[model samples]
Target: MAIGTLDAAAAYGRSLKTLAPAIGESTAATEQHAGGGNSFGSMIETMVSDAAGSLRTAEAESAKQVAGKGDMIDVVTAIGAAETALDTVVAVRDRVVSAYSEIMRMQI
Candidate 1:
């Protein structure tokens, strides 16, 4: 809604490109011994996998706390981590959507 939001989104998109090659190199290493595909896709896959794992851990810890088998501090920590992961995923999704929209707006 604001110019600053667009600026931030663009910045994040640029940052993602900067990080992509590190992901690509790791993906290339694994794929070289197996087969090959898009490293960007692999990077996204890894990101989603990690986010899901974080949410699962948070749920498990909450369950343990409910059952009185986990410490409150540990449960809180896990939930906080999960929340942060979810926030990051949401932010990335927003940036991706913003980038795609900008791409579609090109006169070409």
Candidate 2:
């Protein structure tokens, strides 16, 4: 891959690692607030939404750079990260939906 792409991936990885603890804490707090009745499906949905938001922000930054309003490397990196993040979110959504369908199809 290109250097910009690699850099973006690294940055995205770091960002996820840094944010994970906070996300987990918030998720836990949300579950506690709901008296522990929060479903895994809802938690996954929330995470996917968060990923989508991050991707949107990255795409905006990338667009600004492409318009000559920002750094080229930074812009390229951000775009790559955004695309990857969005793809991941989409994949997770697909998996979750599939799992839900399967559960519904059970004979129980």
Candidate 3:
């Protein structure tokens, strides 16, 4: 299915909302919270790690549900969070790739 611009915008807003708490924080604050060095690579690494964690949580929830030990609501929520995190990671990756491609095509 074709995704409309509005849908894309809404998805971007949702992703931003998920990360709103960290958006305006200082680099030092972010580094402290993230428990790592202050750099773009480190920030991306943190994001990817968090996304992986979310996906793992979702998988665990699904397994629990399959084994009849998890609440349906919890499973659904975890899955939703995982989906959002994955979307955010994919969006960032896409932007990075696009920027790289643009740079490669630029005249020196």
| Highest-scoring model, lDDT | 3
Model 2: residue 33 alpha-carbon error in angstroms: 4.6
True-vs-predicted CA distance for residue 77, candidate 1, Å: 0.5
Question: What's every prediction's RMSD, in angstroms?
Answer: 10.3, 12.4, 11.8
Tens digit of per-residue lDDT, candidate 2, span 5-74? 3344345444544564666767665544334246553444455556666777777887787787988777
lDDT of 2: 0.62
lDDT of 3 at 8: 54
lDDT score of model 1? Answer: 0.69
Full ranking by lDDT: 3, 1, 2
Model 3, 1-108: lDDT tens per residue?
Answer: 997433454455445434636578666555453464565545666677787789899999999999999999999999999999988878887898799999999999
Higher TM-score: candidate 1 or 3? 3
Q: All candidates' TM-scores?
A: 0.66, 0.51, 0.67
Kindly give the number of clashing pairs for every candidate: 0, 0, 0
Model 3's TM-score against the true structure: 0.67
Better of 1 and 2 by lDDT: 1
Runs with alpha carbons beyond 4 Å of true place in candidate 1: 1-38
Candidate 1 structure, TM-score to reference: 0.66
